[model samples]
Target: MPDTAASKRFTVPIGPQHPALKEPGHFEFTVDGEIVTNAYVRLGYAHRGIEKAAESRNWVQNLYLLERVCGICSHIHGFAYSLAVERLANIEAPPRAQAIRVIVAELERIHSHLLWMGVSAHEAGFDTLFMYSWRDRETIMDVLEGLTGNRVNYSANVLGGVKFDVTPTQADIIRKGLTFLEERTKHYLDVIMHDTMFLQRTRGIGVMTRSQAEVMGALGPTARASNVQRDLRVEAPYAAYKDFPVQMVLDTRGDLEARFEVRINELFESYRLINQILDNLPEGELNVRVPRRIPAGEMIVRLEAPRGEVFYFIKSNGTDKLERLKVRTPTICNMTSVVRLSVGHQLADVPMILAGIDPCFSCNDRTVQIRQADGGAQPNGLSSLMSWEELRQYAIRKYEAR
Candidate 1:
């Protein structure tokens, strides 16, 4: 890394703690007269040792822990984890259970898209769009709570199946809620496409070519906006997606506007999928019994999350506890695109570019690997973890020096 004090380039730091940031992350933008020349991000503030923590807990308990990975997309995390565990145990969830899981997952997609819409609008300084989008988002949240008895972190998944079933009355309520949300979603989409002021903030700015997005390893609607055909739901169907297939939303123009369109159109896709599942809703037992101990095996499960593909790898040791578990979230992939895309753009556009990825640093910060500011790895990455005494002493030394 060049010495910034000696160099002509000015550095701007956006924090590990900042009001503008929704999550904990440190980003540095090297700017030249208000135009960003280069950028980079450092994550780890939210690391909770979830992978290591899962090893000590039983299979059932791990489900609860993993679901808390992201409150916005909790169902997908549990859905992926449960599918992996069930596959390892050689037990398949009933058809009805698979359909119910899909219903919840689609509802989550709706919830996530709306929440993202509002956040991005706020970043663009369009508070009216932000306010109206969030107000309409409550319908989806209400529907989810109605079906699962909770809004966020709906613990819908179990080892062999789901914890709850969608009854007729609940299905009708969902249909009505989605009906209202669908109409609102169409209006929001029209506003994003036609509103001149919002377009000024979104239209040709933060433009990423399809190849650029692919080379940067972008995921979810971020990649889809660039016309990348990379949705795991269609490429590799999981759960009941095989029965009620999804239409992948795509856009040729890879800009902020395209990102908004892809996600807004995806809301329509989710509504269609949910209605299909509910109409042809399968009938069967929600769960099946499994042994207290899982058979020794290794399994990798992948599902299309609201953001992108959620990958989970689980290893069983023929005991109730897992031998190892690893999760690779989509945000980690899409974050790379943000840093690369920020270059050559106005510094003022940085906030919207960051929001463009729909980043969830909390979900991505499962582990920490220390590295120098120059981006070289430490001698032993994991070896840098300090013990309780060392951590306490280190804090005291820093405080005393300050």
Candidate 2:
């Protein structure tokens, strides 16, 4: 007989406070020797009940509240929320305000992608790339601060329209920044595609085919990397995207390398869109008077965030306060995919795999806990994860019923 004890399975918990994850998330990975057999995620540690809290605040106040959902993608949260509210009120923002919204949104995307690049490079032990990327990222941060008087939460988008306008002087500064960013982005594309050391870690790792990505409900660059071609800006064209169109970025490789390429390519497109919007820079009112109380209605708004597609469900009961506000962030949708991809990979690859999806535990834990199948606590349910098949059916039924 063989010594089965030597090959026994064990569990590794990477925590609520680990060196790998900066946020408060606990993960348990079951491993057979060095290979991961299964993985589960728990995220209540950072839960703030933000969805429920949105019910207590009025529509105007909730704009700032939702902006706190994700510091990196703060503008998108407010943008989606405002769009839903505007739809419920049966109104549209002015052309110039809509145009300004798109400019701020694109700038936020550029900063977010650069931030993720630096952090992911740091995880792969490429501190040189990390530092360089972050240093270059500051140029955009300066432009954001100059435009909105704040860097993180620009608060440029109000309920009816944008709160500020881009001056000719400011546009000149932005043009210079975009020129630098375009050149730096090209270098990053070259490095990620050709660098042998970076390729060794990302290539052929965390591979998800286009079908697998679609079935798993992946979104953003993760889906684009697999050639899913599901960008809301391109497909739906919200805000000023109709005026200044976006060119969708797709990669058929369906690997981590493809993800890097997609995002870097997206930066180029964002740079192009920003310059066009600035050049055209419409002239109109900054905002119109929006009613305090919204009409009784409900609407769903989806926008492509830096990480993935962020879905917002807003319901109004003819009041100043929302009757119900449901936010299905991209991290929650992508978390299951991350756990699924972790299986069969080496233990050392877990960090890279998590980073590859750009997991935002802070955004994922905005509301509830991961419930068990038997309606019990998840601590005793190791295999009770919501599978890709289940999520797919749920989405299908959701849209079909709608």
Candidate 3:
């Protein structure tokens, strides 16, 4: 329930329970008539303590846990973690393993983007687009299951390499699926670009200038829509991306329509890349043996997830368990853009604006670290950590004062 005590202007609060938001997040939009004058957002309701949980699990065990970080892009989560661990162990996945990883990653990208498009369309009240897109998405889902024996997690990536391989039969199935999806995706692109009804909801809506995107730290398609070339695949190639490079899809309009264009065009790119990997898969062992005890050191893995850059920081203490692990997901970085962009838009447009970023609330809900303004080191060079009890009390005081 919203507080009864109020200010001069009306404030509309949406979620931690709302029809528009599928996940838990709270937003207060201060509107004057139909125009939003200010906006505020609060996340973290879906925090799963995955990072803290990773500290207790062994290196191989954490692979499963971390992949659950975001179901939509689960393969990328495991891919990033395995890459970071391989660096720490001073080993690399075999060339064929790397190529297989890329194929699976691209397949996941197809799944994620299609899922996001359906959700975004639903947010816009376009049930037709939502339904059709989701129906086509099952094609990719089926291909993934046929290849890896799972629809969502896939669990394809292990420590040194992947656990699965692409057989000739699986390759034929994937090619057929891609052929169907490519045609459907092309139709989606045409619809978003020329549909009169859809344009009213997306074109020029939530327009963020190029400078604004750069200043606000937009990532993935959000930044790329603003013509910010921030794809890690092209900038810092990894895995099979080093062998089979991708052309970063970009758009300069910096609006909802541009985002749709950039992502749909990216689907075509993913399709091309997947076919390339399957045709030129290298021959080698899937995985290699690694010692149970990893050397004491720290490493960071940055990968271009379906959603921009997914960052991972790992600290191994020469044991099976990790000492410290931190993940800064793309949604957190893009959340700032959502709030600032919502201001001055219509009240009804907020949902579309929020969905434009394809947020994964749970994935972004990591532990928060409070630092000094100067970003200087604390005493003993270790930053202070906020406890749950202290944070609860702080929230109480803040609300009571408000």
Give each model's whole-structure lDDT: 0.89, 0.89, 0.90
Q: After superposing candidate 3, which stretches have Cα over 4 Å from the reference? A: 1-7, 18-21, 366-402
Instruction: Work out the TM-score per prediction.
Output: 0.89, 0.89, 0.89
**Per-residue alpha-carbon lDDT of model 2 for 102-191, expressed as tens digits?**
999999999999998998898898999999999999999999999999989899889999899899999999999999989999999999
- Candidates ranked by lDDT, best first? 3, 1, 2
Candidate 1: C-alpha lDDT: 0.89
Off by over 4 Å in 1: 1-5, 18-21, 367-402
The residue pairs in collision within model 2 are: none
Question: How do the residues 1-402 of candidate 3 rate in per-residue lDDT, one tens digit apiece?
Answer: 564545458899989874254888999999888999898888878788899989988999999998898878889999999999999999988999999999999999889999999999999889999999999999999999899999999999999988987889899999999999999998999999999999999999999989999999999999999999999999999999999999999899999999999999999999999998889989989998777888999999999988889999999999999999999999999999999999999999999988999888868974345443344456677656656677788789889999
- What's the lDDT for residue 216 in model 1? 91
Model 1, 1-402: lDDT tens digits are: 776764887899988884244789999999999999999888988989999989988989999999989889999999999999889888899999999999999999998989999999999999999899989889988888888889899999988999998999999999999899889988998999999999999999888898998899888899999999999989998879999999999999999999999999999999999999999999999999877899999999989888888899999999999999999999999888888989999999999988888888878997333322333345654334455576678679889999
Q: For every candidate structure, what is the RMSD over all alpha carbons to the true structure, in angstroms?
A: 7.7, 10.9, 10.1
Ten-residue segment with the worst summed lDDT in candidate 1?
A: 367-376
